[model samples]
Target chain A: ETAVFQTPNYHVTQVGNEVSFNCKQTLGHDTMYWYKQDSKKLLKIMFSYNNKQLIVNETVPRRFSPQSSDKAHLNLRIKSVEPEDSAVYLCASSFLGGRATGQLYFGEGSKLTVL
Target chain B: QQQVRQSPQSLTVWEGETAILNCSYEDSTFDYFPWYWQFPRESPALLIAIRPVSNKKEDGRFTIFFNKREKKLSLHITDSQPGDSATYFCAASNNRIFFGDGTQLVVKP
Candidate 1:
């Protein structure tokens, strides 16, 4: 099954709580990305990693951090959840070479709701 | 600042109609443009894509019209079905991809 996988399809927590989302890809892609989709459907990039090396880090808050164990695994951890942090966190992966360049395969995003 | 912009935050159309979604970008260095579609409670999937070298690309009922001179592109979903109802995201890529605030399309049967 060549696809991206995300655990905890949905989660609900109160403010000041900590949460973590895990992602893994079996498509053998080189790059993995985290995108935050707000209630308004605005997609914002949070971080990107290539081969376990940080490549692109957007203007996200310090409370948010991304951990990559290998090219296939990327995890997001929120130290202290805020009300505004409630959104669908999407994990995507892509290949940088060959004919299928720029094509992103996404996981079934992890939805977070802060109370 | 939004690097990629999309218009008509929401659109409602009848089945078998053509739904046109508009998009524009700010960066000229972006050579790749792709449209991703997300169904309710589902993650986004790549629907169609186009490069700057070509002004148009088509797959099935979806077509992407690109204007590199103006840094604008549009997606046309012809013969839209109720299953086509989803949020469409326009994205541009250089070193990293920038996605626009998606346009929600509702196809009524």
Candidate 2:
């Protein structure tokens, strides 16, 4: 069973367009994270939310923002997508403020392509 | 700056042979190290992990060897099979986790 689910498994959009990716976790985990994996397969943390509280922001561009409606849902919105914004966006969830021992559960990932 | 570095961006190993992937980190605060394995079109999953207090951790055929003084670690896959072919990532965390660029491993039968 997939504990975390992401919508629009693949997205293709034009430059300067705004796109939003939705993520939901059925695991009831308190913490959700957004990560971007570039073509080179470098995974970077973009945002982390615990109980709707923004805990970590990795100095991402202002165009990128994360919104959490609740503990189970965390969404990523990108305004004016650029060529560099084309990458795989992954959503993961884990227990809140817990030791790193708990492995993060990840969705298949949403691949974004900007033309 | 890249905190965690993985070597041999790609590796090819024969069936039943042992494959070793190396990784090193620069942050001393990173007390936890985890290895993740990712297959094509799939999300990365935790394979094995080791803490600074332990020198080695083993699960099934996967093992993680850690060296705190050297700030280095390595993953060894014993009796590797073709199914083991995938991209392996090394991640370090103090408070937030950081992943290495990744190492693609191809295991041929």
Q: Tens-digit lDDT track for model 2 on B1-109?
A: 7899998899999999999999999999887788999998889998988899999999999999999999999999999999999999998877677789899999998
In candidate 1, list every pair of residues with a backbone clash.
none
| TM-score, candidate 1, first chain | 0.95
Q: What is the Cα-based TM-score of model 2?
A: 0.95
RMSD of 1: 1.8
Model 2: residues >4 Å from true position, as ranges?
A: none
Docking class of 2: medium
List runs of model 1 lying over 4 Å from the truth. Answer: A97-100
Give the Cα lDDT of each candidate: 0.91, 0.91
**Residues B1-109, model 1: lDDT tens digits:** 7899998899999999999999999989887888999998788888999999999999999999999888899999999999999999998887778889999999999
Model 2: clashing residue pairs? none
